[model samples]
Target: MRTRFRARPRKWGPLRGLLAAAAVGVLVFPAGASAVSAAPLAEQDLGSRLAADYEAAFLTQYNKIKDPANGYFRQFGDLLVPYHSVETLIVEAPDHGHETTSEAFSYYLWLEATYGQITGNWEPFNKAWRSMETYIIPAQKDQPTNSGYNPAKPATYAAEHGDPSGYPSRLDSGVSVGQDPIANELSSTYGTNNIYGMHWLLDVDNVYGYGFCGDGSKNAPAYINTFQRGEQESVWETVTHPSCETFKFGGKNGFLDLFTGDSSYSKQWRYTNAPDADARAVQVAYWAKTWADKQGKGSQISSAVANAAKMGDYLRYSMYDKYFKKIGNCTSPSCPAGSGKNSAHYLLGWYYSWGGADASAQYPWAFRIGSSAPHQGYQNPLAAWALANDPQLKPKSATGATDWATSLNRQLEFLQWLQSAEGGIAGGASNSWGGSYGTPPANSPKFYGMAYDYQPVWHDPPSNRWFGFQTWGMERVAQYYYVTKDSRAKSILDKWVPWAINNTTVGTGGSFAIPADLQWSGQPNNWTGNPSTNTNLHVSVLNKNNDVGIAASLAKTLLYYAAGSGNTQARTTGEKLLDALLGNTDSKGIAVPETRADYNRFDDTYSQGGLYVPNGWTGKMANGDTINSSSTFLSIRSFYKQDPDWSKVQSYLNGGAVPTFTYHRFWSQAEIATAFAVHAELF
Candidate 1:
């Protein structure tokens, strides 16, 4: 039921003509390597050997991502936005292939940053930030009502439900909510009340046709969102809506009534920020600054770095609990509302959100941080370190650096607390139990008074099931360890690296296998006390796969750990893994065949784990597809039926063979490209 795009084996598909032309750059090999060398690469030194391969790998992947003909990016007015994938029929995080996420934008920045590091060109990196700002981050025109935001009363409380049938949670003004601690400081520091952060989702092709603020003109790259119901509500069950709601689409109150129940619904504009993506952008900026400085070109990126600092300053919102409630053993909605830093968890939660009534409306705006500090995949210690230590990237706000400095240590401690007996990190801790501030079971494990959840934020397929989170989160720790020789970070990665390498397989003939899925058991002891090792906590590898993106991430983690700790097997495994990945490369990017049996759920009804529309709550998508009790995932957006890959999915729906696809996801490609650069630079 949980169908967000995870790292899976996928096949290559033909490109779709999606954007205007841009000149293709030729690959510039490093000085020590030849354009046509017949000599065996094995004979050369590691640096000389990998320099050519890494440069070529980075350039090939970069050109594939940037070139318009490849269909990875599309021209959105004056700016550009990358697609989720080159194909149109895929289903994952974004329902449609053309729909992009902040994750993609961050990866795009990373791709450009690597290019600047390799080619010494910083224009592309700056341009990436500009595009991110112009498209994803809501402009003054989009928000238009931050002036109405009240720091004293941020947002009213709404109890979260476990399923879609829990008809729009009613807003209760009587519930106590905390004040916005940093709102005034951030506004005074930046001279603006408007948040300077990227909203998590965008419809790059406007496939659903919810044009800007529902003015009705179909436009590309319109802001949109899904996944609001609860942990059980996966992408397959979502009812898409525009970010700037104007009551012109969906039901009478736009799509607001479907998610929240109130006495009177007001037309509004809202956006959710995926903290990990924004954090990754800052992490990328730090690397960009470091690389550029090495080439005596740091000044060229100073402006962009400053903006990253600004974004980081706003990112502190993620440190607070949702509704700004006190962090600890509060088991009810009546739990004490926190003031100042008491609400700060110091860990990056899943998301931070803000919204306001239309600029003309009388109602005020609201902001909320996430209460669930779930998936470790979202943590970025490197970025936290940069914001805390690097003067260039230090946030301009008064307490931003201090907060990040505390966050750096806290994140490391969180990692230490979550590590399992077998060394795999467990899920996470949550201040708001079950997302409603409900009482947790007595004697439940706790981390700093917050309850431990094996699968924190979401529960469809279990949030921490995929091994990708381990590698993704550990890679940052490894990098932080490699840079600062932080004993805490090293101590954590020392156990994680060996466990990951033990599960990974790098064989001859381009054959390789890394952890695909994981199964966890037991829980860590109370970290509020002495924080002992989790002797009872354990993990088992459920499966193995050659998912290129995850493999690249695992390799990076190992390489960084090996580089810092002098672990020979880690270095060899990382090098061999990278070498194996090159064999999977193609014209568009690296991918392998994926058989999508999950596509069968496209037509499933509510009982079968599909979209659940409340009876009589009739509405329509932009294309006029009706939304009611009978609607399935495919029924609401008829546009997908016209996709070129529709027939294969259709056949599968009709009980035929499962369709296999090779997708070129923007974020995965960027990760692969950067993985090569990471190897070359560190080695």
Candidate 2:
């Protein structure tokens, strides 16, 4: 059974000191007019309107259910519940029971900090900060205080009883700061101890390190220590375990276990140290140490630097060469011994599923190495960002060493290598094993899968099949270019961005007809002579569908690239796309034709009216899919100044009643608040 953390609705609790910090005095601007003469009303005045509305909404809702003990705004019977969850139109009032994750809350914290920085008012920030310190952080640390293992108990008893140490291994999800350790734990099948919780702590530290701590915040140190303690506990768990201690490779003394389980739950490979997880852990530790070092407070984060180095060593020596092999007609010496047509550059299997060796044969066919899955496009860039940010993780030698930056470049190169002459990058690549997972003929280089839901499916693969969300990878690449000014990254964006813009469909009134995605597929080498020869398998749209999230994402990437590359056309096209997105909104600030949908499921029952922005319009596909409005908001916030309809958007969002949406209410509200805060330039 898939154990999900479900939240239950609870009555609004009493407010003690929460009411005293309500956002004071609304800053109203001229209605329906631009506050700045040169800017549109949507751009200049929209932010103020959003600010006022958000403040009002936050105070009104917060006062109703502020937990007196911790000042956390609790609703839906969960602690630290974001205000957006309450305003969703899908679940209705008094029953807003959406589950919140550590990842989502991390985004919320960023929004809060950014909102506070952009807007002069820090009341909301203060509230969120207090809640995180007093409630959220404490909840994350809630676990067994004593060491979970007992020598007298049977070896299997450790698994049954679980880790008793009150370390920060628990990645809490749902309402409130703390919940049942076993129930709230993520990746439980692979042992409750994982790096996700430590990742969350890193996020908290980042929020403070970014600038919140410099402002004389009182609780920043405590939060930092909490994260450090968690990291220490994780290290202790790994070293103390007999299984982990006994595992060895090349005469090495230590083994970094990635996940805690075996192959039973399709996690056979995750039990060993994973490159991705190790990379993240290294980055977190590096950043924590950097923060501590900068503050002239080295003692507070003593173990951070050493911990990061240890993880970095594991990634560099153990995981990199063991799992990651070069491929795709490479002439370079770095390619593995068996590099050729069958060999492809790919991250073996999401992570080293098991320790010490490449165990590719045990899993599903499509998940093995050489697949070059599109999901890696997203993860690789993040890993790159972490490595690029820290010097310790850089390559130690000038030759034959692949550091995080080199890894990022290789990943980017692989994506470009997969691109067809038509400019559409293959969402996935499969070798001869494709037939094992339902592909015809089970031959090598079979392009017979649809790219959706971040998974490559073998169905009627569209010639121009591409995942909309994967375009965000371009943004990461652009960010890399901004930092390193790498010409290769620039060249990739230059080629892909133009192709993306040309394929996008816009209506007469500036509304997007089809969302931003690739519109052409490459020719199949074996099954057909060329793409034109296979009309039966070819899939094309009539320029009537719009993926709002993808559209927003593409526009944001364009804006970022334009800023770096000074590409006037990219900037212009990006602004126009954002304007088209704004055109979808009604006078009340709610996006219309909102639908509740996912990759495999579509439901348009709640399409008529909602408070938050809909994911995207159900166009020709009519899949009833809409993403979280917060995503759209974040994308828009990226280039609000360039958008021509800024004032109108601001007015719509600021019209006062909180906008509603079908799902992910907490994310939507937090994003809306973030957009408004960003516009206000509080950060």
Candidate 3:
């Protein structure tokens, strides 16, 4: 289900044109040029000042890209339009095909609503809401009227029948008229699309009273009810997906784990019912119930509480396992149909076998179907967050809250257990599934020219080896500490933060010190020949440079830890790291030399002009050319304006005009808008 697109070197033809256009009055500021002043604001007024700047910038870009008929923004801006056809509007020409994802739009909706709350600007919120109701929500509810078209069935329907297209198919330009759009929209099918979108809606409503859904009126309640119905329908479809029924685990008849059948990453649709997706769904359902209760519409979400509890039980009892064991031995009154064999057909079997022989020694990482290795950085924290928030998920005991606290404590302890003596946390154990630079084994499950096996347990040996860019775990631990004042969590952060600061070297220099994949056994010697020198597995080594994503994540964690422990030095260092990242900019004030180019697969010219935060400096490509990482501008936007330099970056985005730069379709726009909306007071 993964889509593989090769990156090719891009010429500066388009970029030069953009710059030339900007030189003229082609892209003047939509908002007045005076929105952002040259002088920086005082630290106390930084949040509000930056909020103004961000709002201006968002409007400029939004106006340019928004569809006139429908409020949704197109995928690519004017820069690359000629290179691609109207049908493949969002596709980065000649690479991956055209497709739009709900997550991007979901993020946009959340951003607009959040910013509106922060600034009391309802214009953006109205626009975003209108787009959602007009296009996205209607698309999910679209289905055939025939009796064969069961709303509860776990099957996909055509986008043609759906109102307002289900996916981003063509540009609104006249040249692409009358062409039918093609999309394999899974989120809409599985209910995730609605659930995720509703989660944000609930968040905005909770923060800024009811009736904020396009001003106070009965329309808000009506829309919520419609969304709730869609969400409920989608969840039913998910639990009934053939895979869920076929592969029942831990006595749960309708327990489900599946991904939206979207084609993007190499791993898409390969597994079903991912723990992260389920946990998120649980939160969405919980929030839905809470929102309904607050509005005196309790009947609207009467079943939501029970649904969330069921999902939570699945996560805790069925999915959460301390050790890998046969599905039959996994739980009391073990799964009757459990088989002790490994095959793709036997989902549980594959999971248990992949657990490796040393399961007894390992701490429980959240279990994902088709694999036993814990996704420590990605899945674990989300599960913790969901479990901590929902009281219905807690055991029915006098000390139910205590049990929740204990669960979080244990999860933190597992993270601490994985921390190296040198203070770096090992990214969870590597799954036996193989996409190694080396050859595959005979029994390997062949997919995408890689092997998938369940043998040879892999864990980072106690050393300085750390997973590349695995800072989310630290962020979650810090967040837990901030909320609960847990001493263990604080202690872990106290030790790890100083160690990370020391280990992280700044500047583009001699050897790329950040190992993309650090291994202990050193079996995969494909990275650097000098793996023996470091006593850690060196999967891939990028040249020494500032990694925006890692830097931002680490800085955020440091900020959280500092807030909780009153550690002034940690706060100072965190701000310093952010300053360094914000400083990695070109003359035009765009963050330069992208480190994570793999993110935006379409534009092959890795280190081109864009507002991308580089993965690291001196990042070496496969062709022996050292280039900047790709732009994850949106992801980095949340940390915007932390320093004076960022104000200039915001100015460029607001309407300073750089024609050569291409606007990413959904993700970038949403992230940038969200980043601008971030309230400075929180920091």
Model 1 ranges off by over 4 Å = 1-50, 528-531
Give candidate 3's TM-score. Answer: 0.43
lDDT of each: 0.81, 0.32, 0.32
User: Which residue window of length 10 is worst by lDDT in model 1?
Assistant: 13-22
Question: What is the per-residue lDDT of model 1 for residues 471-574, given as tens digits with 9 covering 90 to 100?
Answer: 88998898888999999888888788888988988775456888888899988888863435789889999888788888889888988999999998998888
Candidate 3, residue 442: CA error in Å? Answer: 20
Query: Over all chains combined, what TM-score does candidate 1 have?
Result: 0.94
Residue-by-residue lDDT tens digits, candidate 2, 1-683: 00011111111100111122233322232222222211112333221333443333332222222323321234322224443233222221111122223334434444444333332333443444344334333221322211232111101100111121222122211111111112112123324322222112211212212112112233221111110111011111111111112222101211121222222222111122224334434433443444445545445444344444433432332212111223232222232333221222333122221211122233221111112223333334544545545554442333212344555655665455444444444444432122111222323343322112212312222312333434545755665565467776787777667767776765534356543223444333432222222222222333334544455556556666776788877766665554454454322221334322211111112221111222331111001112232323112122332334334334434453222232224433343333322222221
Write down the worst ten-residue block by lDDT for model 3: 224-233
Could you tell me every candidate's TM-score relative to the true structure?
Answer: 0.94, 0.45, 0.43
How far in Å is the alpha carbon of 661 misplaced in model 2?
A: 7.1
On the 0 to 100 scale, the lDDT of residue 336 in model 1 is 92
Model 3: per-residue Cα lDDT at residue 122: 37
* Candidate 2 Cα deviation (angstroms), residue 603: 12
- Reference-based lDDT, residue 181, model 2: 19
Candidate 1: residue 579 Cα off by (Å): 0.9
